[model samples]
Target: MQIPIINRSRHPLPAYQTEHAAGLDVHANLAEPVTLKPLQRALIPTGLFMAIPVGYEMQVRPRSGLAYKHGISIVNSPGTIDADYRGELKVLLVNLSETDFVVQDGERIAQLVVARHETIAWEPAEELSETARGAGGYGSTGMQ
Candidate 1:
């Protein structure tokens, strides 16, 4: 699956770290460092543009180490990049910890996973079938 991309940043292209890795690591492309105070969020640019295939989309996700270490996370988790978008890729980062965190140029901040998706058309129905868990909302299943 070869997707065309335009990378205008000084940082390297996002790549999978190991064999069978699902996501590629992406970095920040900034002229200067940005600081994020507690509960603050910013849109950090990646300086990357791509033409994703019609059947596929890019999913931006958080780095677990950053979230567990400095309490950093993506504001819109699993941010979706549609196939039609042709602009620079930006990441919405937030500081969930009490202390501030600095974002440096070319710092690995997120991961992008390319996945195949399906487009759905709603079928209007008058009634639906039932199941054992029907109408059971969040946490309705008891722990064993």
Candidate 2:
């Protein structure tokens, strides 16, 4: 399936992949030096917009490199992008580490994954079936 992408700027950006069942990487370009103090939140622009198909959603996830190296991560990791939303894609980043994080323009900040979901009808049930580890919560799986 072909996905429409809008490049408002004069410069042409790399093509957005719609065939592959993978996430699209978003970049943040920091022309000047700026710091994101610990626990500080900021809106990072990706300079891109997309036309996503209906019945599908895009999940915004953080890049491992950015999280591990700079302690910068998506405030709402795996943020959902509804298909009907026709607006500029923005990244909300938060600095977790106790240091100022420098973000450069064109830096890969996060990834957008298109996913499919199923809506099910709910029918009230009297009870659920019993299991070997019934009602076991959290560490019920046992520590590795």
Candidate 3:
């Protein structure tokens, strides 16, 4: 699916690196490097604006390499960008390691995954149906 986007930054538009990649890698748009000390978080801009189609959303997610190698993660993992938002795309990144992490311009900081979503209407109900594992969560199931 083709999307209409406006890129104000010098970096190229976000794209899928592999043939079957589900998300497009988004870059950091900054004039200078931003440093994040341990347990610190910052909102990094992407300088990208998009007219996301209705009934769809853009999900901002962390890169596995960064999370595994540098303990980098998004403060709001899988952040949702609604279709009506017409603003710059920014990523909220956090340093989960013991040291500082520097965010350089044009670096792939997060990914943008376009996903189809549904609009739910609340229905007032007196009672709900039961299930086999009703109200069972948070390690209620045994681990292998």
Candidate 4:
């Protein structure tokens, strides 16, 4: 699937590192490094604009290495970029570690995954169909 993108920053366009990678790596477009103290959050920009297709969205996700090694992660987890949005791609990053971390210009701060989505039509009813494990979630099932 080919998507149209505008690169306004000095860095190259984001791309998938591996052939089978689901998400493409996105970078920061800051002129200088931004420091995030403990428990701090910031909206980092990518300096790139995209024309996402209808019925699909761009999901901004966290990098596993940053989360595991530095306790840095995206606050919204999978941030959504709707199809109609025509703005720079920004990431909401948070520092979960005790120490501060510096984000450099053109740094791979997050990953963008393109996914197809659907709109639902609600069929209101008095009562819903029953199931054995209805409404059970968040570890409701036994752990092995």
Candidate 5:
């Protein structure tokens, strides 16, 4: 599936790192390094714009290495870029550790996963059907 994309930054476009990879690694587009203090959050731009096909969305997710080593994570994990949005893509990053983290230009900070979504029309109903696990949530199932 080919999608229209505009790359305004000097860095290469996002690409899958390995064979059968589901997401493309996205980089930071910054003129200068940005530091995130402990527990601080910032919006890091990617300098990328794309026209996603209808019924599809771009999901922004965190890199496992960064999360494990630097305690960095996306503020909105699995951030969604709707198909109709045409603005530059920016990632909301947060430092979850006690130390500061520096974001460099062209740093691979996140992954972009293209996903297909369905739009459903709401049908008003009085009550939902019951099942064995109906209404059971949040550890309702005992942990083995």
Candidate 6:
């Protein structure tokens, strides 16, 4: 399915995907650097904004290269962008490694994947059917 994206600027920046199966890469281009110290968190902004279509949302995920190479990743991995939101896309990055990280302009900080979500109506139930491992919590099954 084709997703319509509305660029808000006359000379709007382009969003790119390296490959057909790849997620759309978002960039942040500011005059000053966006640094994250050890265990520090900050919101890095992309110079551009987008208008995502209804019935769809954008999932912001970490770039494998950045996470593995620099220990930098999105604090809220797969951050959700609701359809109703109309603002600049910002990525909340955290530095888990013991060093300062610099986010440069036009850097592919995060990947955006379009996803479809469903809203379900809840119905109250007095009792639920029992299963073989009813009420099992974490590690209920043996770990080999």
Residues 49-132, candidate 4: write the lDDT tens digits.
999999999999999888999988999989999999999999999999999999999889999999999999999899989987
Error of 4 at 99 (Å): 0.5
Q: Clashing residue pairs in candidate 5, if any?
A: none
State TM-scores per candidate.
0.97, 0.80, 0.96, 0.95, 0.96, 0.84
Per-residue lDDT tens digits of candidate 1, residues 1-144? Answer: 998989999989999998998989999999999999999999999999999999899999999889999999999999999999999999999999999999999999999999999999999999899987777888987733
**What TM-score does prediction 2 earn?**
0.80
- Name the 10 consecutive residues with the lowest summed lDDT in model 2: 8-17
TM-score for candidate 3: 0.96
lDDT of 1 at 103: 98
Best by lDDT: 5
lDDT of each: 0.95, 0.77, 0.94, 0.93, 0.96, 0.78
lDDT computed for candidate 5? 0.96
lDDT per residue as tens, model 3, 8-88: 999999989999999899999999999999999999999999988999999999999999999999999999999999999
Q: Which portions of model 1 miss their true places by more than 4 Å?
A: none
Q: What value does the lDDT take at residue 54 in candidate 1? A: 100
Off by over 4 Å in 4: none
Stretches of candidate 2 above 4 Å error? Answer: 9-21, 29-34
RMSD of each: 1.2, 3.4, 1.5, 1.5, 1.3, 2.7
lDDT of 3: 0.94
Runs in model 3 with CA error above 4 Å? none
lDDT for residue 142 in candidate 2, whole number 0-100: 65
For candidate 2, the C-alpha RMSD (Å) to the true structure equals 3.4
- Residue 42, model 1: Cα distance from true site in angstroms: 0.2
How do the candidates rank by lDDT, highest first? 5, 1, 3, 4, 6, 2
Better of 4 and 5 by lDDT: 5
Local error of candidate 2 at 122, Å? 2.3
Worst 10 residues of 3 by lDDT: 135-144
